[model samples]
Target: MNFPSFGFGSPWVLLLLLALPLWWVARRRRPPSAIVFSRAGTLAESPRRGQWVPRLLFLVRNLAIAGLVIALARPRSGGRTEESLSDGIDIVIAFDLSSSMLAEDFQPENRLEVARAKIKQFITMRKNDRIGVVAFSGEALTQVPLTTDYPVVLAAVDNLQPGQLEDGTAIGTAIATAANRLRSAPGRSRVIVLLTDGVNNRGAIDPRTAAQAAGQFRIKVYTIGVGSRGLAPVPVGRGLFGLRYENRPVEIDDSLLTDVARMTGGRYFRATNAQALDEITREIDRLERTPARTHTYTRYTELFRWPLGAAVLALFMELGLLAWRAPLL
Candidate 1:
C-alpha cells in the first residue's frame, strides 16, 4: 500500500511528441499509388499480411513510455509523518464531591454523574498522554497515580461521588493535589482540568495559592463550574403514595472558578446541563492537542527505459520491412 515512488511517474510520456515525426517518416516513404508495375505476376503478393502487428508494437511502446514518465516524477503511493509533534503531555483530572453535587439541578443525573460521564470520554481521547485523577469533597486525595493506561485512570473516575471524603467542598485542596502530582512531571505540556460545583467551603489551603503553585510548575489549569442558577427540588419526606418531595436553592461561585483559571493562564467553562457539559468537554479536547510541525519527505527511484526503447525499435523496424527492407516475394 505504501511506496516511495510509483512506476508511472516517469517522463517517458514526453516521447509521445515524437509520434508526429514517426508518422511523417512513414508517410514520406510510402510507394506512389500512381505508379504501375510492368508485370502483374511480379507484384502478385502484397506486404500487408498481418496489419495488427506493427500497431500492437506501437501500443506497447507508448504504454511503456508512459509508465517510465510517471516513474520519473516520483509518484509516492503513501506518506509518513516526517515531523511528529512531540508535545508530551501530563494531565490531572480533579473532580468535586461536595454534598451540593447531589442537587437535582442537572436532572435525571446529578452534577457528579454528568462530570464523571464527560471525564470518561476525556480519558478515552487521551491515548498518548499520562493522566491522573483526584477526588475532593472536604479534602483532596489522589485517587489514581499518573499513567498512560486510560482504563485504570477511568476506573478512578468511577470511584467519585458525594460524601466520598467528609461533607464539604474544598475547591483549593483538589487543585493542590493535582499540582503536587504534576510538580515533577517532565512533560513539556502539563495541565489540570478541575470540575467543581460550589466554592471553597472547607480546607486550609486557599484556591489562589493552589493556582500559584500550579503556575510555578508551568501547569495550565482549566476550571469548569458545573450547575445552573435555579432553585432545584430535593427529597425531604415520603408522601402517602411513597413519593418523596422537597426543594433547595444551590448557588455556584463563579468568581473563584474564574480566578483559578485566569491565574493559571487557562479558560473557565460553565456547564448548566449534560449537553453543555459534553460541549465543554469537547472544547477542552479542542484546546488540548499538540502543536503542529512541518513534515518532510525524501525518496529515491530507479527507472529502466530499455523496455520502451525496445518496443519503439520493434515497431519501426517492422514498418521499415513492410516499406523497403523486405522484398515483395
Candidate 2:
C-alpha cells in the first residue's frame, strides 16, 4: 500500500529519545532493596503473585516517557500538489491510401496494415499529445480531428484501407489538409507525419506548393516513403489456384518527399520494412518531444495527539498500580 509523506516538524526535539537507554541503566544500577527474614524458605512456600507485575509497571513508566518525547517532536503526515509546465505538441498523421500501399513487400502483411500497426504504436507512446488522422488517395479527407482522445485516432487509422477514395496519390492535398487542421491548434509546436508509398500524380495542388504553405503556417512535416526500392510482390487476384502474387517495380518519389521535409524544416525517412518504419516513427517521436516542467508543494497535518494520549494512559496505569501496591502510611 502507498502511504503519504510523513516526518517530524520539530526534529531537534527527537534527540531526547537518547535518554531512554540511560534511564533504563539507572533503574537497573539502583535496584530496590528487599527485607531478609530468618525463615526465607517458609516465606517462599506462602502464596505469592508473579514477580513480572512490578517489572511490567517499570516498563510502562519508560514507555510513557518515550511516547511523551515522540509527541514533543511533532510528527506529521500529508498533502502535496504538483503542477506541470510543459505543453504537448499537436500532431496530424496523413496516410496514403493509394493502391500502391497494397504491396506485400513489407512482410506477412501489406504496407497499409503495417503502417496502421506502427501508427497505433506511435499513438500509444504519445500519451500527452493531441493527434489527428488524414487519409488520402486521389483527394484528402480528415478522418479524425485534432484531439487528445487517442482511441478515436487509433480507430480512424485502423479503419483506413486502399481504394477508400479515388485511386491516385495526392501528397499535396494530404499535406495541405493536415496543415489546415493544425492551423487553429493552441499548441506552439504543430507537426504532420505524412507516409506515402507512391508519387503525387492526381492532386490539383502541387506537393511543393503545399509544403511551402505548411512552412508559412509554421507546421513541421515529417515525410516517410514506405516500400522497398526494387521490385515487390503485389496481389493480382484470387483465381483457380488460391491467391496470386505478381512482382511489380516499387515507385516512390524520395526527392519530392525530401524536399517537402526540407521546406517544412523537418526530416524525411525511407522505410523498406516494418522494423525500419517503426524506427522512423520512434525517431520522429524523439525529435518532437518537449520536456515538461513540474512544481510540487506539500502541506502537513500534525499527529501529536495520538502519542500524547498514549503517554497519559501509560502514566495513569503506572500510578494506579503503584497506589494499589502501596501500604497505608
Candidate 3:
C-alpha cells in the first residue's frame, strides 16, 4: 500500500529536540555524595548491579520529552485532489442516411461507412464534452440524446443505416432536430455537426429558417458535404446475391450548405473522399474546442494526538517504574 504525504505545521518547534542530548550528559555526571566514606571501596559488599535503574528512568524521560517535541511541531498527513472548473461544450452530430450515401466514390467502403469511422474518431478526441447523435433521411430521428457517454454515441453512429428512414435527404429537418437537442444544454458552447451528401428534398422545415433559429439559441452549426465531384457508383437496389450499383452524378447543395453555416456562425466544409472527411472532422474539432480548467487541492489531517498520547504514556510508565523501585531504594 501507499502512504500519504507527511509534514509538520510548526517545524520551528522541533528545535526543542536539540536540548535532550545536553540534558542527558548533565544527568550522567555523578553529583558529590552528601555523606563521605572512609575509603573508595568501603561499600563494595553493597550491590552495584542496580546502578542501571536510574539510567533506565532517564531514558524513559528523554523519550517522553522527544514525543512532546514532535507533538508541538503539529505533524499531519495530506492527500491531493482535483476537480474540473468548467463545463465543457455540448455537441449533436446530424448524420445523413439517404440511399445516395451508399456511393462508392470513397473507395474500400461507401460514404456512410467512412463517415461513421471519422465520427467515431472525432468522439474519441473530445474530453469533458457531452455529445448526441441524430440520423436523418426523409425525416430526422434522434438516435441518442445529449450525454457525456461517448460509447453510447459511438454505438448509435455504428448502427446508422440508409434504410432506417425513407429514401431522401432532409438536411433542414436534421439541423432543426440537432439544434433542439443542444438548446437546453448547460454548456457555454453548443454545436451541431451536420454531415450530408445531398440536397434537402424532404422536410417540413426550411434549412435557412432552422439555421436562423439555431443562431438565435446560440448554437453553431458546422456543415460538411460528403461526396466526390462528377460521376460515382451509387447503389440502386439489391440483386440476387448483393447490391447493384450504377454511375450517377454526385449532387451536393454546396451554396445552401455554406449559407446555413454562415447564418449560424459556423463554417462549411466539403469532403470529396475519406481523407478529406477525416480532415474536416479534425478541423471541426479544432474550431469547437473549449478551454477547460481544473482545480487541485491538498487536504491535511492532524496527527498530533498520537504523539501527544505517546508522550503521556511514556511519562506514566516512568512514574510507575520509579514507584515500584522505591521500597528497594
TM-score for every candidate vs. truth?
Answer: 0.60, 0.63, 0.66
Tell me the lDDT of model 3 at 200.
90
Please give me the total number of clashing residue pairs in predicted model 2. 0
lDDT of 1 by residue, 201-295 (tens): 89999999989889988889999888877776554555888536467665678888899899998889999889999988888877876643434
* TM match of model 1 to true structure: 0.60
Summing lDDT over every window of 10 consecutive residues in candidate 2, give the lowest-scoring window.
Answer: 34-43
Rank by lDDT (best first): 3, 2, 1
User: What is the per-residue lDDT of model 3 for residues 1-329, given as tens digits with 9 covering 90 to 100?
Assistant: 12458878888999999999788777569574443333235336554544565667777888899999999998888754667666477999999999999999999999989999999999999888889999999999999999879888888988999899988988889989999899888777899999999999999999999999999999999999999999999988999989999999999999999999999899999999999999999998888867556566887798999999999998998999777552122
**Weakest ten-residue segment in model 3 by summed lDDT:** 34-43
- The CA lDDT of each predicted structure is 0.74, 0.86, 0.87
Error (Å) of candidate 2 at residue 300 is 22
What CA RMSD would you report for each candidate? Answer: 10.8, 9.5, 7.4
Over 4 Å off, model 2: 1-83, 236-244, 291-329
lDDT at 129, model 3: 88
Best by TM-score: 3
**Candidate 2 has what TM-score?**
0.63
Write the residue-wise lDDT of candidate 2 on 24-87 in tens digits: 7886787565632224553487635334456768778877998898899888888556787864
Pairs in clash, predicted candidate 3: none
Please tell me which model should have the higher TM-score, number 1 or number 2.
Answer: 2
- The number of clashing residue pairs in model 1 is 13
